[model samples]
Target: MKLVLKDYIESLKEEGELDSLLTDLLWSVGIKIFTRPNKGTRQYGVDIAAYGKNFQNSIEDQNKEVFLITVKKGNFDRNNWDSGKNSIRQSLNDIIDVYIPNRLGKQYNNCKINIVVASNGELSEGVIDNWVSYTKEQGTKNDKLNFVFWGIRDLVQLTEDNLLSELLFPEDHRLLLRKTLSFLDLPDYDLRHFYELNEKLFQKCLPLKNNRKLIKNLRLLRLISNILLKGCVEMNNIKPAIIASERVLILYWDWFKKRNSFNEKEPIKELISYHFFKIQINRIYFAKVQTSYYSEDGLSFGIGNLLEYSLITYEQIGISATIGMSELYEAMVHFPSDPNYSETCYKNAMQVSQSLGELIFNNPASCYPKYDEHCIEINLAMILFYQTERFDIAIQWLEKLISYLRDNYLLKEFIPLFITDYEKLIQIEVGGYKEEISSSILITCLADWCIMLKEDNLYKNLIELIEQSLPNIDLQHWHPEENTEENLFNSNAMRETGSTRSSIKLPKNPIEYEMEMVEERNIFFDETKFLHNNKGFQHIEYLANRHFRTYVFPNSWRQLLNTRFCFNKP
Candidate 1:
């Protein structure tokens, strides 16, 4: 598949194909471009002019010499062979005679000029030999002039080395996917091939720029994961799915290590955030696969291997947030089978939870508070304790969560209003509530836990706190300006949604309205501000359903309903 794609790209005759590819190839190898092929001109026979610094220092420090590149695309078949050679000679002549003289008198007199002639196909043996001899002779005549050649094979090798081949030849990727599927039936299976394939797949999906770039890369990542997961599922075997997911974790860990090698001046939060989401997808895949299909033995082996690898990743990469997630995964995996070990796992998780909160969420230097990590950690603690029937520990985590929410002013503003609107919509369908329920989800969860423990005093105090806070939560700040972009989106969502609820409108089928809301509400302090409101509702909904499912199903609560579907079903 790789060879076929390389050949196809080599055969391309479209204008700018060779130039753009050469640009990418040079850029990947740390050549800093001064100018490249301009829109409508041949760029003085120099396809790309760049500083070809020594390879090691090229990326790390400044370059002192210039390299002028000339790229051509053609075979040496009789008709055009002379033209191709002549084109190269002219490009070299331009660099040595005109281009260097023009630049040297101004800014680069002492610097050397290196001529690179890159072509899509090889010259005949005699032609290359003669060309090299003449090029070296010319170099001797001009003390600072040196030259080199990059044939199709060299370019392909460069592309592969830097993991940029997929972007250069996207069609090759599509073809490779087909080829991968075909190899599934082979007697000798190579998991390393699958691993390498996923490494490229993930590299293509990484932001490679900033946090905003991740907004789109995330969707691409999901699309890729879905395709891979779907393919594994179609095999009617869990092993392939597990193998793919294992490879994902390994690659993701390597990405984390690589990010560390980057200069500390770079903003690392976005890269860490990217890793957060990547781990999130892996966690979800494992949860789904475990519940849906895998045998107990398979599940144990895969998750155990994953958890062990995660520990090593934590030690090597030293990202506490990732380790926090690994512990949470460990807890979840231990829950159904090893009840005793589950508690131990959750305890380990809670410690990292605290450390992560202190190091990231509480650090003022952090642009976005690691609220997603906070939520995951807090929820894991809540679920772990609640499952173990430790009401006191569950309440502690719940209180801690409410305090976390209170620290973030935006969440404090949005959660109550969102919950109030949600509850009012609920009452309009059913009857009004017997009591005035407070609009905070954590408060509600605490109330449930308090009642379960028969702590009537604590439950009553919590209710009082919620009732007082709900009225104080100013909804005015929550509403965007009437004519602003935010309000325009809200208006559009309201008009387009066929929702029965009179409070807040559900998004249009596209749900861009929700994205707009997320954008408006996304404080840098918490990148998950968009998700927190939705996830808060989800947690409450899950707890409500769980409450009903348990021995504590009360007559008063019997009519309270669950609207969301569960993904944890067997």
Candidate 2:
């Protein structure tokens, strides 16, 4: 009763008598519409052209003045037909001026214009009224115009006259007729053929129901049928493109389930999840590219590489791992602590991570063109070293990263030297550097290093600088708006404060610090000298206090100053 598109199409392909039965039904209807005698030949420009009946009316005559009937086959609202009237009228004009005039001579301009519309269900009163109005208008304006409409009730009445029964043959043959009729795009026929065929098939194959191969084949057939039907309906409506794509995926899943039998449910579930996950990842990648965080040209290489690794390495390794057999153990580290884990899942996750890393860091030219290669190279080296827990190497890499940031003038256009390591720093470029700090990476890196070194003061200084910089740095500010926040905070304080504060917490392992106060906003540091003058400190404190006083409570500035400078700390 509520058949999906696939089901309707599959019903047409049924074997046994059902298939033949349906073909006969359609053929009979075709004959009735095309071969009737003494009917006025007029090209109504209907979707279907049928002509027959008299010997004098050959196929050529049918081609010229055949009944141009539009068949609306499914559960469409009658209003749709009413709305389509204007389009139908245009189609009629095209038939008369473009198609019929040349062949029948201009003298046949008075030829009959018969418009017939057939539907599978009854037309609503509103649709009928609209149709009546259109017909009356056409007839009064042009005496040659005529129309005829048929509903499902009319077809049923004809069937009761034994017309359809006479067309049926053997019992099995009747099933084919039913199937054909069910699949036909006949406006005046119900799905009785499909229902009858399905009933017959189920009865005959009751014993073979449990056959695995049969079941599998049946499922595939069903999936294909659904796809075809859904495609047809979508083509008719032109709105369900996305829905149609989703149905295709569903059909694919069904086919996949039938082809594999490994515990059936688990693999199917995992496959579907993986499919959707890949779609999500692609969406995120596209969104990033659209936002300019990634260049368009880089996307082809990045996405292509990712897909290749995923389909080849990940899938192959995963399959092997699932079976408890994998040679990739030498390449992958597995914790023996977890006994129930599958190596394939872990390997797949690692491969995905690797692919994502490639996309993020591979095309530095497009991603970070203004920065010196040495700067990004060192930063990446530091990231790798940090991940491996080689703290000393990471620190060395960070130093190089810092030196590159300070030296590169174009990089300075987007990022101040001090905040280069913060994660929010990237957002600066992304947000168009209008309101918020152009970068947060410097803060993030500072925090990471301080936390690693167990230096509380360095971490505190980083946090304080971030807080102080928050108000002056508007994330919404962009070019031409005067980079006022650009030179507001002393970068020298930002770079040195992390080490200076860390020294207070680790006096024995004190890190040397030197401050280069180029301006209010730009600062640099020399890590060899663990010294920061009180002059630079006073300037930073002044700006912090001023900002706090104006934006926050005046009393809060004193409290913040005391907290930041250790004036009140025990």
Q: Tell me, what's the RMSD of every candidate? A: 22.6, 27.1
TM-score list, all predictions? 0.34, 0.24
State how far residue 521 of model 1 sits from its true place (Å): 24
Residue-wise lDDT of candidate 1 within 395-498, one digit each (tens)? 55445444544453333232322322435534432463333322222333344434434445554554454445554422111121222222121123223321
Off by over 4 Å in 2: 1-44, 54-65, 73-113, 141-144, 154-570
Model 1 CA deviation exceeding 4 Å by range:
56-64, 76-86, 103-105, 164-570
The alpha-carbon lDDT assigned to residue 487 of candidate 2 equals: 26
Question: How many pairs of residues in model 1 come into backbone collision?
Answer: 1
Give the winner by TM-score: 1
Identify the candidate with maximal lDDT.
1
